[model samples]
Target: MSGVSGFDIFWLIFMIMMMQPILRQKFLEAARQRMIRKLEQKRKSRVILLVHRQETMSLLGFPIMRFIDVNDSEQVIRAIHMTDPDVPIDIILHTPGGLVLASLQIAKALKRHKAKTTAFVPHYAMSGGTLIALAADEIVMDEHAVLGPVDPQVGQFPAASLVKVRQTKPLDKIDDETLILADVAEKALNQMEYNLEELLNGRFPEEKVKELAKLLSQGRWTHDYPITFDEAKALGLPVSNNMPEEIYELMSLFPQPMRQQPSVEFAPSPRRTPPRGNGKSLI
Candidate 1:
């Protein structure tokens, strides 16, 4: 047999390089499934994750933002349907929000589940993510995690602002397009408020439901305003700060697309304080 040529060696190296990413992805996926199984076994509940992150294309090296869409709603709803009615459900939400219609579909499906439903926010869940969180019977968040307002947006403008403009501006001064947008905005606002009320009705008192519905859907705050744990409690949401350690571990598995240099870094292990009166530090 002839000895391996230089060209053959180059081709072998090239093939291994190409296969590396595929093998890595498979390993990561297996690890995630194992984590999910462990969590389910520990909590005796079904686990569903609605995580959205920037996905980088391997060839183009461009990032694409993922969000809740019709496809996401379909898969989530299918998961809910496949689950037994008596089993509790835990939703791990991590998104900057997405389509209102898609979010509503997911919210309704989760609300219809017979057993208790919980939403866990390890970071921020804004806009439409907030809408889905509202449907859960309980919301569990990390101490520093945040939720956001669910105000409706029409195109690039807030529905509340559009409606305000139509009300304040003279009929002759307002353009036809502006008037049309205002009309649509009013309708969207009403629909959102109604749906929000419906989701919150049984969980809170009727008066409290109406108040929360109007407050969240009226665009009182900017779209991305972070509602901290204290604020959420003040607002009477059934939110708790007792987050599970497994949740943080699961989030680590869904790493953001790679970058040349990471923006933030810290020691991976937990820190412990030295014993009282001891001169030495504890590692």
Candidate 2:
């Protein structure tokens, strides 16, 4: 049968059409697996993500609650302990920040680990997220990646905003309750600055460490302001714009949040709070 009969030709065409979707799906699955494997190989570590997606579960178009909270600190620590101490770690961080102490805990682990640690920010790492990145020996970012102000947020307001009340407003005009908050804000900012300095001290000079702590925790910019790779490098962070190609592919696996803005209803307190659950919080 050098040439297929008419019936044979029809069957071949039908078979191709039927197999297209199955073949496409298999191809995608294989591609995804390959991407993950490549990412692991390139980084030379098991990749872990600590990300917070901004959108929250809403009711009638208004965010009624937040789902992501729990810091996977314990889990992360376990993973690190299980790994050979000499092996490098690459943490992919994309968070809006969380409990300060939880972030600090993870940061301390990374700082103490004998292996080189790198933080990869594909989109954004903010607040406590910034704290974790600070602990890493190096920060890898894409041109579009963002790291934000790490100033602690108290209740519904930024600690800096509360502190500003004391700096910019006349003392007499401020209420006793507002004054109390302002005082707490100042104390929080100072404590954050101190801790931040400690985290960066070994890697950076005294002056540079002070500068970063001030810029990140003292709120020179808005808490949500996005500091790109160039801006981060200028600020004396160990930032490299060069990123692995697999990072983008990996990030693509996580879909963007449905909401454009973070839910304002559930404000994380200044103190360290446990994560909501295993639920994801990603940029």
Candidate 3:
């Protein structure tokens, strides 16, 4: 048998590397088309739109559609018109909160629509992203689906993140479990209510709004830890509270997928300052 020369080996390696992107792009486009097909099969859209951003491919790598800035509201509106000028449209969302303003706009559209508008979050929907989900007539999340704490987590103004602006003392300095009996989770949740009040001011009444905000923020925040589908139901989001036997068997550590858009929070990736950084890098 004849063996290939060293030059052939180098050429082969380069060829393989070049082929990777082509193959990946083809796979991605196919996946996008498949998702659209699945939504079409749902039978509820005169205009069926599947909107995914940073959590998926980020709209062909547009910088504006950053991981946290999903300007989906306008996109959804446009898709509805293009797909079906007169019929109702269905939009699917998968995002990890990107831009607060963008999320709010998307949520507003969902709430204003008289037609049936269903929001499906197959993965985690956190912060402002969750706001968009809240506007939906019905939300579909699996038993393992995760919804992040709605507490505004900011760092550009390390002075304003939920765990920051409010804590007069350092948060990491947050006393250990035994010393902190006030359940940080509960307090943060109360704060979440206040923030939502400002965001949804005239949208819902104070009493109803407060109740809605508290229930949604009803749990602790920890990375890689998600509430069971039942736990979310108890928290009171308008999701399809079902847990099929198969999904229940899967580990609950996985985060729900979320695409991002752009905005203040996404302007710069926020970093936690020891809640009291000494103006020097700790790591």
**lDDT (Cα, tens digit) per residue for candidate 2, span 1-283:** 4877999999999888777645654665577567767877876876666755533223222323222244478877776787788888888887777788778888888888898999999888887888899999999988888888889877888899999888898999989998898888998899999999989988988888998888889878888898888988988889997788778776665444445575544553456876687788866
lDDT of 3 by residue, 1-283 (tens): 8899999999999887767645655766566565555545555464233333422223333222334455455676556446533344555454556555566666666566666666655556665556766776666776556666554433332112334423556657655752243344445456656656554445557776777666444434542245455766776556794322322222121212333752333443447665876788876
Give TM-scores for every candidate, taking all chains together and pairing residue i with residue i. Answer: 0.94, 0.72, 0.56
Model 1 C-alpha lDDT per residue in residues 1-283, reported as the tens digit of each score: 9999999999999888777666766787899999999999999999999999875435444567898999999999999999999999999999999999999999999999999999999998999999999999999988899999999999999999999999998989999999999999999999999999989979999999999999999989999899998899999999999899999999998777787899989999999994586676566
Preferred candidate (TM-score higher): 2 or 3: 2
TM-score of 2: 0.72
Stretches of candidate 2 above 4 Å error? 1-37, 54-68, 257-283
Predicted model with the maximum lDDT? 1
Q: Give the winner by TM-score.
A: 1
* RMSD of every prediction: 2.0, 15.5, 16.9
Those runs of model 3 whose alpha carbons end farther than 4 Å from true positions after fitting are 1-13, 46-66, 70-74, 80-88, 156-206, 214-228, 241-283
Q: Which ten residues in a row have the lowest lDDT in candidate 3?
A: 246-255
